[model samples]
Target: MTFRIAILGASGYTGAELVRLIATHPQMEIAALSADRKAGMEMAAVFPFLRHLDLPKLVKIDEVDFSRIDLCFCALPHATSQEVIAKLPRDLKIVDLSADFRLRDPAEYQKWYGQPHAAVELQKEAVYGLTEFYRDEIRKGRLIAGTGCNAATGQYALRPLIAAGVIDLDDIVIDLKAGVSGAGRSLKENLLHAELSGGTHSYSAGGKHRHLGEFDQEFSKLAGREVRVQFTPHLLPMNRGILATVYVKGDPAAVHRALEAAYAQETFLQVLPFGALPSTRDVAGSNYCHIGVTGDRIPGRAVVIAVLDNLTKGSSGQALQNANLTLGIEETTGLMLAPLFP
Candidate 1:
């Protein structure tokens, strides 16, 4: 039973990635593709790499026939997704790959995103799409909100530690580095080859990064208190992947055991051996997050490093995983492909 799917914002990096992964899926088919700017153009025209496969021509969101779409992956930009999703059929199962619905609190959403949510009712009903932590909720919900790529990476490293009470809640710090592609395919002065390549710089420093809203919301909920981690995101010259170097004070062995126990059954998350670190290159182009733990040279502290392709495990792949559950398919279905290697 193949489910018919529609991908909104199909001309973006994550949207093309969804097309790439679903091309090989056994129980999913792309019935519609929407990219407002690229409407009337073939997907191959926007992404030449996808030319080998036959796909629907890009169209406007309203052009899609919702009655024929079993599920919709909304990969549109943050502020735009809420408005677009609000008008979709109420019965349609949606997996939003934007920040619009991630935070449950309307006040928090406005605080971080700089605008009040247009669809408050939908925002309240949207389930957080961290598949590993919210699998049950996701399986039974009609709307799922994908976490930020950086937020997802950092959570993979710290969630278990927080749950196990193995780390100091107030002292956590997350220093993340992300590939250029995570910024989206939009034109930016800083993302040019001359400006981006051969150089790395940090942005959203000093706890100003928006993903901190997620860390605060999720980590606080997990610890039963307000837990804020100092988060700083750096832009790497590469095209994909995210590496979050997390600093925490805890028993290294206990942290390792907590993560191992938490994700032992998870198919997409891997915990490397202690003292061994992870690299973004290893998990590139796949729905896999590799985590490593090591004690800091200074006693009573540990370093947790997590790496994954921001475009894959961090966004589209995560959306697809939640969509499978919403459609009553196997959670891992269509997502078993191994990490891509050079």
Candidate 2:
């Protein structure tokens, strides 16, 4: 019972990542690959690391035979995904890796993305794809929206604490550092080696980052109020990973207990022992999120740190995890690879 899968926007970072993971999957086959600009080119030309495996040649989205694909991973960019997905077959299961359908409210989407959602009805049907938190919904959904890399890292650190009522929701703060790959494969002046290699700088400060929409939506829903966390993202001089340092007002011991208990049974999420901290290098290239908790020098405060590969666990891996559930397969299938280390 192999599942035939189609990957739209196959030339991008996340798209290439999906191909890398699915190539070795026991029950999944890459039947089609779509990259409008790269159509007719072999994937190896775009991502040589994937050259070892035999795969379908890239094609345009309209050229893909959707009727043969059991599932489609839409790795297209934000605004572009809505237009493409709206025209796809309604019954085909989809895991969208873009920001298109992540926000349930179209008005919220417009507020953050600067435009009204083109597929409001589809947005209504899409389930938020935080695999551990929304397992049941993802298992029954036809469309699942993957969270932002930064959003996923922060939530893995705070969701449990918020759910247990162990933290002060009013004073939450998140400082995240992300690798260059999270920006995608597009060329940018700041991403050049001469500009990015030597130092780090913050962008989207002052509550302007688009992922704040996700934080507001998910956190508020959990606490049953409008919980807004102060967030600032920094660009690190690396190629892959995200490290989020979260500050919360709570009993440090209780924060550790809540996190350990919540992720005790999760296969891909690891909660380190209290007082221990996590590093992005520890979880690089794997579908695993490592979280550590420690008490602040000031009483009644705690710092929760989480790290994961921005390309793997943050986006493509999360998408595949949800796809497994949507197809009624084992959730850990094709996603148990260990982190790469020197």
What do the candidate models score in CA lDDT, each in turn?
A: 0.93, 0.96
Writing each residue's lDDT as its tens digit, candidate 2 over 1-342 gives: 899999999899999999999999999999999998889999999889999989999998988999999999999999999999999999999999999999999999999999989999999899999999999999999999999999999999999999999999999999999999999898899899999999999999999999999999999999999999999999999999999999999999999999999999999999999999999999988999999999988999999999999999999999999999999999999999989995
* Weakest lDDT window of 10 consecutive positions for candidate 2: 333-342
Q: Please count the clashing residue pairs in each candidate, in the order shown.
A: 0, 0
RMSD of every prediction: 0.7, 0.6
lDDT of 1 by residue, 1-342 (tens): 999999999999999999999999999999999998789999988999999999999998888999999999999998999999999999999999999999999999999989998899998889999999998999899999999999999999999999999988889989899999999999999999999899899998987889989998999999998888899999999999999999999999999999999999989999998889999889988899999999988988999999998998999999999999989989887788878788
With candidate 2 superimposed using the best TM-score fit, by how many Å does residue 109's alpha carbon deviate from the native?
Answer: 0.1
- Per-residue error for 83 in candidate 1, Å, reads 0.6
Candidate 1 error regions (>4 Å): none
Off by over 4 Å in 2: none
lDDT for model 1 comes to: 0.93
What's the lDDT for residue 308 in model 1?
93
TM-score of 1: 0.99
The count of backbone overlaps in candidate 2 is 0
